[model samples]
Every structure is written in C-alpha cells, then in structure tokens.
Target chain A: MADTEKKKVIKPIKNFSMEEYISSGHRACQGCAEVLAVRHVLKAIGPDMIMAMATGCMEIISSPYPLTSWNIPWIHVAFENAAAVASGVESGLKALRRKGRIPNKDVTIVAMGGDGGTTDIGFQALSGMIERGHKVIYVCVDNEAYMNTGIQRSSSTPIGATTTTSPTGKLEPEGKSTWKKDMVAIAAAHGIPYTATACPTFFTDLQKKIQKAKEVNGPSYIHILSVCPTGWRVPPNKAIEYGQLAVDTGVFPLYEVENGAWKLNRKPKELKPVSDYFKGQGRYRHLDERFTQQIQDKVTERWNKLVELCSEKPEK
Target chain B: MTKPMEQISWQEIEAGGVITEPGNASCYHTGTWRSQKPKYDENACIRCWRCYVMCPDAVISPDLEKNIFVWNYDYCKGCGICAYECPAKAIVMEED
Candidate 1:
C-alpha cells in the first residue's frame, strides 16, 4: 500500500525535467511571477521544443537585439504576435519535418506573453491561432498589468487593485473598478484541446498543465496568475506567498479544463479571507470595510461558479 | 494485476504529461562544445577554469589550436560569467 501511494505521488510531477532552459541572469524584477512561470514551464517542456516570446517583459529582457539569456532555440517576435508566430513555427516545423529538413521528433512550440498582449492587444491573434487548431501552447503571464511598461492596467487586472493608470484615491474604492477578464473561460470557449489556470507558487500543478499542453495535439492555453511584486507594491520575496494567498482566498481558483471537462485541482479546505490577499498590496490598501466585503462576495460567487462547473457528476 | 490509482489522478496535480523518457532526453552535446575553446585576453595571461566550471548547460570547450576558450555561441545565453570570473581579464564578452 505504501509503494502504491508512492507511485500515486509520482504521477503529478512525472515529466518534470532537471534541465534549466530559462537560464540564470535574467533581468526580471525580484519576485516577478512571470519569471517563475517561465522557469517552471521550461523545466517541464524540456529541450525538444522551440519557443517564441512576445514583446513583453520576457522578450525585452531575454533577447534585446544581440543579447539573449535563453538556453533553448527562441525567436523574439512582435508584441501581439507571440501566438501567431508560434503557430507559424508549428506549421513550418511540420513542413520541414515532412520534407526531412527539421527533426521529426516532437517539437513543442510555446508562445508566452503578458496580460497586455494576451487580453488586450494579442487577444485576436491568440484566439485566431487557437481557432486555427495548430499544435502549440500559448501561455498568458497575467500580471494584470503591463509590468514591463510601468504597470498599466489591462483587462486581466482584478477588480480591486491599483495600477499606474488606476491609482487608489478618494473617488476609486480600489484602483481597478472592473472585474477581471476570464481568460480561461474565453480560451475554453474557443473549444481548444486544453485550457488550464495555474499559479507559480504551485510548481507541481504548473508543470503538469505545461506537460498536458505539450502532450495534446492541438492548441493549448494556460493563463498563469503570475504575481508582480513591483506592480502589486509588495516586497520582492513575497511573490510566491501572494500567489498562494490568491488561490487560498479563492480569488484565483486552481483548475483545469481538459478535453471538455472542467476539474478543480485544489479546493480551499478552509477558505482564507480575501482581505489578507488585499491588505499586502498597496493597490487595494485604499479599500474600506464595505469594499473589502464586496470583493470577498465577488470572490465567493466566482468560486461557487467554478465548483459548479467542476461538479459534472463524473460520467457514470 | 495492479490498477491505476482511483483518486483524481495526481497527474492532474501537475497536468503531468510524459514525452521524452528520463535519461534519454539528456542533452546530447552536453559538456561537449565546452570540451575545449580559446580564451582571449585584452589584458592579462591568467587562465582560470571559472568559465569551464560555471557553465550550467556545460557546453564550453578549450580550443587547443588558439590556446584559449572559444565560445559555442549557439548554445551560450551570453551570461558573461566567464568575463567576470576571468582572473587574467582574458575572456571578453562579444555579441554573436
């Protein structure tokens, strides 16, 4: 029975590689969730893949003209074309393999962009690529703002947070008044092969979604709520902690939409108050008691909605 | 016969998907390109193995012909550790 349990534990992080593709010496801010997501994805995807980066924080730092910190074959494309570029690379690789030019071995094409690219500018290309049904994985490093461009609010920005454009003051309860855009449901609506939401604090879950996206034959999307320490006005080291708090508070539920089924990976055994998730960040520091409860109510409602979707009686 | 675990597959815990088998997918040219390369000094003649040691992917080589470290720029991330660690001020970081 003990051996059986050991085998069970091995399944989740099964394909996690020991290799490092996102190499050290990157210029991302201390405790940037985007960097953590990239690090984990690289370890999961391994060396058999080629990546295309967008004109976000990753592209600007990893490859600025001649300089690059990428250990794998990478192409730095325009701001909004990471997904489209990846789709092109996927088709090119398929053609090259058919003609015996490139190796026919499984070559995963992953495109990574920030929330600005993903939810705002790159959404059409991203949706088009997914609808086109190419074998690729597009990850949106949803920091909720354009961190590389001084933290401007994007559609992915949460309802109660401050950004450069959405500073907390007398008029605004929290910086951002709009509810966060649901990128996962949007991607799921595309009817793609797989869509998952992950947080960098949970390395095991992050890697699995990456592996699933790579294993599947068609387009896969993962919207990772990568925390931005600088943008969120938190200390550098608390990035991972904030990620855990987001999930624990049900502000960001950990779940996956695989094949056609939605599965909640981690249910909060005891839900933490949404205030803890809010209090640490300067963005939501302006929220009063009533606004805090309002945010909590919204989170609870969203969490219940997720539970309902994941509650499909598991096909008898 | 043993059956797969019944609890929602921990595979879902990570989205654990398997592709290249362990050990087989190990880097092919690892510790190879760095096997030997030429190291040039704009200043001194000290030869330390910092470049030889700090390579995480381990793809550096000592060029026996040029008697210095020649970088395998194809695989290098331009980390510049070698340039910083060169005791002799020998290794220079150049754009490729």
Candidate 2:
C-alpha cells in the first residue's frame, strides 16, 4: 500500500536537463520571467532547434552585439517578421535536407517575440505563417507591453494598467481604456495544430506543452505570460508570486487548443478576486473600486466562457 | 578565449556581426547589480530544486556529490526569487 501510494504521487518537476541553452550572464532585469520562460523552453526543445527571434525584450537582452546567451542556432529578425523568417528557415532546412547538404533530421524552428511584436506588430506575419501551414512554433513571451522601449502600452496590456503611454490621470483614472487582446483565442481561431497558454511559474507544464508542440506537424503557437517586475511595479522577488496570483485569480487561465479542440490545463475551483491580483502590482495601483469591479466581472465572464468552451465541442 | 567587448575591433567581428560562440555571455558578470544577496543554509534545505527552477539567471546548479544546490554568484543578480520561493526557509536575503 505504501509503495502504491508512493507511485501514485508524482512530482511536478523531475529529471530536467542541467544543460543551460540560454546560459547565464545575459542582460535581463532582476527576476525577469520572460527570460526564464525562454530558458525553460529552450531546455525543453534541446539544441536541435533554430530560433528566429523578433526585435523585443528577449532579443535585446540575449544578443548585445559581440555576445549571445543562446546555445542553439538563433537569428535576430525584424519586429514584424519573426514568423515569416521562421517559415523561411524551415523551408531552407527542408531544401538543405532534400539536397543532401544536411543530415535528414528534424530541426524544430521557433519564432519568439514580445507582446507588442505578437499582438500588434507581427500579427500579420504570424497569421500568414499559420495560414500557410508552416511547421514552426511561434512563442510569444508576453509581459503585456513594449517593455524593451521603456514600458509603453501594447495591445496585450490589460485594462486599468498604467503604462508609460497609458498613464493614469485626472481625466482617465483607469490607465488603458481598451481590453487586452486575446491572442491565444486569435491563434486558436487560425486552426493551428497546437496553441497553448503557458507561464514560467509552471515550468513542467510549459515544457510539456513545448515538447507537444514540437511533435505536431503543422504550425503551433504558445503564448507565455512573462511577469515583468520592473514594469509591473512589484518587487523583483515577487515575480513568480505574481505569476501564481495571476493564475489563481483567473486573470490569466492556462489552457491549450489543439486542432480546434479546447482544453483548460488549469481550473481553479473558485477563482480568487481580481483585486487580490491587482493589490501589489504598481501598474494597477491607480484602479479604484468601480474599475476593479468592472475588471473582476469581465474576468469572471471570460473565465466562464472559457470553461464552457473547453467543456463542449468547439466549432471547427 | 574572447577579448573584452571594448578591446575587440569591428574588423575582428564576423561578417554580419554573428557571434559564433554559443552562451558566451557567461563572460559578463551581472553580480554587481545585486543590492541584496542570498545566503544558503545547508541544514534547513530540503533539496527540492525549487530554487534551481525559479532562478531567473540560471545561476543555481545541483551538486549531486554533496547532495545540495550551488549558486554561481558570477551572474546572479540577487532578485531573491529562490529565497522567496523556498518553503523550507533555507535561503535568506542579506545585504550585498
């Protein structure tokens, strides 16, 4: 019975690689979850991958002229063409293999970008890649703003968050007027073979999803919610804590869509209030009770909609 | 061995400024950024690897021989994520 019980209990993280793909000493901020997410993703994919990264936080931090943190083949592409470049690389690799120039082995092609690059700047290229059925994994390391350029607001920035461009004022107490763009939903709508929402706090889940995405033959999209301590106005130590709170509060539910089928990876029995999530973050400090309630209601409504969608057969 | 960033000239840089070396940023020390640093207490540690996974800078490594994790201060920015996430309270933050 003791042996059986021991076998039943499974650890969340186990047998992880000690090899660092995106090695230490890069210039990411203290407790930056975006870099951590990329690190874990690279570890999951191993060295057999080619990364086409857009101009964003990860690009800026990892590659600064004479040095790079990446241990794999990586290319720095323009802001709006990471996906396009990834597709091209995938095609090039295929041709190279066909011509016997390179060995016949799968080299997973990945395109990485920040929230601004994904939801705003590179949306067209991403859509085109997905539409053309390229076998590339597009990972959006979203800290929810243009953090590389001094924390300006992006489409992925949530409502009531005060960014540099969307500052709180006497006229507008709530920072951003618009809702955060649903990029995962948009990717799922494209009918990609795989699309998932991941967080660095859940490393095992994130790694599992990445491995799953690699196995799929068509396009895959993974939207990773990277907690930005500098921009979020939280203590650097509270980065992972905020990531946990975001999931517990249902502000950012973790889920995946595979071949038009929706699956919720994490489902809280009762979501903690949105105010609990906003209390420490500096970005949401200006939000009053009225705005807080509005956000809470919106979160609950969306959470319920997501649950319903996950339970039923999604329209193909 | 690569020269310091300032010492290297533009002509020495590869065509298109490609960095042939992988993970060469390990040369740059980021430990100077830390205002507070983490001190590990071996007796109280559980060896759960929470600190290993949570480290943003990837400075923590497992010392299997000693059955404990080690921190490489060369790149640790000292965000205290490991200290904060430690359930056993094995890691404490101290003034740098």
Fnat (0 to 1) per candidate: 0.00, 0.76
DockQ of each: 0.02, 0.59
List candidate 2 stretches off by more than 4 Å: A1-13, A314-316
Candidate achieving the largest TM-score: 2
Candidate 2 local lDDT, B1-96, one digit each (tens): 466577779888899778998888777889989899999998678667889998989999877666667899888999999999999899999999
lDDT of 1 by residue, A172-241 (tens): 7567899999999999988888999998778788888898898898999999988877788886546767
Candidate 2 lDDT score at position A254: 99
Decoy 2 TM-score against native: 0.96
Looking at model 2, what is the TM-score of chain A? 0.95
TM-scores for all candidates: the values are: 0.73, 0.96
**How does model 1 score on DockQ?**
0.02
Query: C-alpha displacement of A89 in model 2, angstroms?
Result: 0.3
